[model samples]
Target: MTYTHASPEHGAPERADDVDDVARILQPDGTRVSDPALDRWISDLPPHELRALHRDMVLTRRLDTEGVALQRQGQLALWAPCRGQEAVQVATAHALAAGDLVFPSYREHGVLLARGARPADFVLAWRGEEHSAYDHAALGVAPVQIIIGAQALHATGWAMGAQRDRSTDVAVAYFGDGATSQGDVNEAMVFASSFRAPVVFVCSNNQWAISEPVTVQARHPIAGRAPGFGIPSMRVDGNDALACLAAMRWALDHARRGEGPAFIEAVTYRLGPHTTSDDPTRYRDADEVERWSRRDPLARLEAYLRDAGVLDDSGLAEVARAADAFAAEVRAACIGAVTRDPASVFDHVYAEPHAPLERQRAEYVDYLDGFSR
Candidate 1:
């Protein structure tokens, strides 16, 4: 969603459709804006923690670039780039407690990393080396869901389970603006509302859903849809790391406190193609990309940190070096990944061995033996 400054000091939406109450704590120019309602959530963060957020964004971006490079090099089948949506991804992940769970779409690499997934775990699925790259149980994250907004239903169901168990854990569902139009997402919201499930719906409205613009699918702010489901919602400046963090913290807290499900529309932009197979240039204008580039989340956060004396030139250099090192490690890991046995594909089909699955697995192995013969 676009916005117009109400005054020289603050940004205010010119129309209700623009989400008149969108929360913004940092401007594109790196100036900090006071958000009375949301500020307290992140007020206790120290300079070091703030710096960590910057580091995570830089690292996540580096990982994304590496993924694209690997895919282009034919090392991986495909990759989803999360270039400009780092703030929303990283901040929302950080908002979760260790006990909380996440059901994320394919593009949430930042969230996976934040939740303790290894670099190898990020690429194994893309490489076709494994059905699932990470141990979801250990990470408290579900396997990456590629079927659009289906993860929303999974999250809502899990939240209902947690509610029944009387656990404080919140289930968070992360998807793009495109997913909002999906029936699964809408149904998930309805169920979550009816049961007062402890879930947070984070819709990263990154302008485009693949080649389709958000404007094409929805007439008003995506956040506005939540009210109809009896869910409290907020629209936030996804490019502003602090604002994203604050909004996520607020949503998670609300859910964790048994306040039912909450929704967040993070107004961000995708600065790259949807995936390795996508050609964004065909649909988006170069000038539009240039315009959003000025609102680069990483750059503005870096600027804010530097201005606040949290990170000087040396510190910034250190972060760059660290990100580079991490990316190199990830690259090496992806390139040298051990290929999984083909027959092992049948291994995780069910929790325990089933007669039909076992018979199929045996037949599959026999077929492989025939190939050898």
Candidate 2:
């Protein structure tokens, strides 16, 4: 689905009134807000488009589940599950233009998938076979940054480039709430505001950074921090696909109109371990998981569709079949990816060859040859 550039006359100005309007539409109790503009926006979306969002959430959830299984089976070194956070990734990425660049944290497999990165490509990364599985220039996606908040710097730099070229394309940086404490993240905000860079800083505030709860990071809401950096910010119900889509649309529009960077804090839960290597049960309560399960993105969207008569039992069964088939394919690719060469570690180190690296590469090859004998 594509979004057109919204003119000032097309929608209400994003002020206190609009914020209140959006908050009403996204109330947690499923009450419908009375607004012609909001109703029209929701009603204008075709059933197929809504179903597509459902499919993306289902497929990405399945991918995260299978990835966990692969790690358990010793096929991957590690895996980060975006289990309950699918809406933040899928809806936000879907709201972007083809020309926009995405700076992803390592856990944003769903974003990569939405940006057209194949399942095999993502598998290769977790299999520890490649730092990045695709050409960033080709995909308009940066390599997944493992160092928390580092991608913010790269995203800000890319935004600067877009501004210099007078391009309308925006850049999006995906990071967790934990990254907010990082110096690089703060620096990126400074640069983005100072230059009024066309970018969106998307914080998937899943409420944890590994074992730490978000309360340890900030006493107030994380979105409130954006205004201090001279950027407008909003909080969206990350479990609600429609809310995420709307918030992302607003952020992207703000960027495209030369209004400078906007911040989106998607309030969601990470219903799984930080990674396959970590056991969340030790740190978090099972009751907490059960609670968030009630607010599951897939279930919420499915309920919305069923209520609207957009999806039925038979349709859900078909989606299940497709999800299963896709998961099987991903599993097969991930298993194969595990056996690939551990070489090529020296290939992309530098644009110009380094003498020390060359020597080390020769020695490594000789050591491997010795094993053959």
Candidate 3:
């Protein structure tokens, strides 16, 4: 079921149908807008809690910008910019409990940050020095998956394991709009629903999958696909920090209560290129970027904070200072990543080496020794 609100700008029906669409809490202009039911949820949250949410959004954006800068400086091989989707990562991650495990696609640096994953470890993989930087046991965050939708299966399987142990802890899988096209993601939804696993599937629908628009992935809204897999779903304004938090909290509550999996498709935009490699201007228009810029998540959240008296000019300045310091630390960490030893490549290939690999390793060592002489 969907709800339709008349467009405040045109006075015409903003949305013709609401079959799979969901209402948003914060409007593009920074007004505290929301559906009656969801409004109560946010209204009930403490003011201090709300301010923290805003802070996370600010820091996440800074980290994303610094990441892109690192890529340009040749500190990292590549970077995936989440320039416009800070709210989705921050709000959703804040909703999760410590017991929950999070499986993230490569772009979910914000989620990793919220999960207490060190920024230094998060960037090491991108710096081409390590495949995974954090110990999963310590952070409860799996290594960033580069194979797109594959992490969804890992999340679902983990949730199934938790169910067998009779644990109420849930699992959350983060993926992009483009990942919806992958078969493993579909299979994950199937298994989660069939076994009633406690999982939340978060689709950060940033409109563009690399250069391809979401239209190429789905004929209707992506949220509509949830019903087919027997999972309830909602679409929230990805740029609205408050709404994203409320929607995520709702989904997390449902999953932890043993209500099975839930899906959240955050309707947002990718304000930058797909990564450092691609130029968006070739396929998308500059005007489109300008249009989304007006709806900037950081600006909207600041407006709300000012209206609530939780943030003044001094508070804003402090946040900026904090962000600058954090960015500098990240830059330093990237520059100081340790170089791997030449023989380290074969160290972790096997706990008990097989005959074929042992033979290959011996030959490779001999070849390298010959070069040294």
> Which candidate ranks first by lDDT, i.e. highest?
1
TM-score for each of the candidates: 0.94, 0.89, 0.92
lDDT of 3 by residue, 294-339 (tens): 8788888888889978888998888888878888888888998888
The segments of candidate 3 whose C-alpha lies over 4 angstroms from its true place after superposition are: 1-21, 350-360, 369-373
After aligning candidate 1 to the native by TM-score, how far in Å is the CA of 45 from where it should be? Answer: 1.3
Report the Cα RMSD per candidate: 3.3, 5.9, 3.3
Candidate 1, residues 1-373: lDDT per residue as tens digits?
2122242245432332253257899889899989887789998989988988888899999999999999999999999999999999998888789999999999999999888888789888999998888999999999899999999999999999999999999999999999999999999999999999999999999888898888789866788789889899888888888988998888888888888999988988899999989999999899999989999999999888888989999888898898899888888888999987777898878899889998998898899899779
Candidate 3: TM-score? 0.92
Error of 3 at 108 (Å): 0.3
Compared with the true structure, model 1 gives a TM-score of: 0.94
lDDT of each: 0.88, 0.81, 0.83
In Å, residue 226's CA in model 1 sits off its true spot by: 0.2
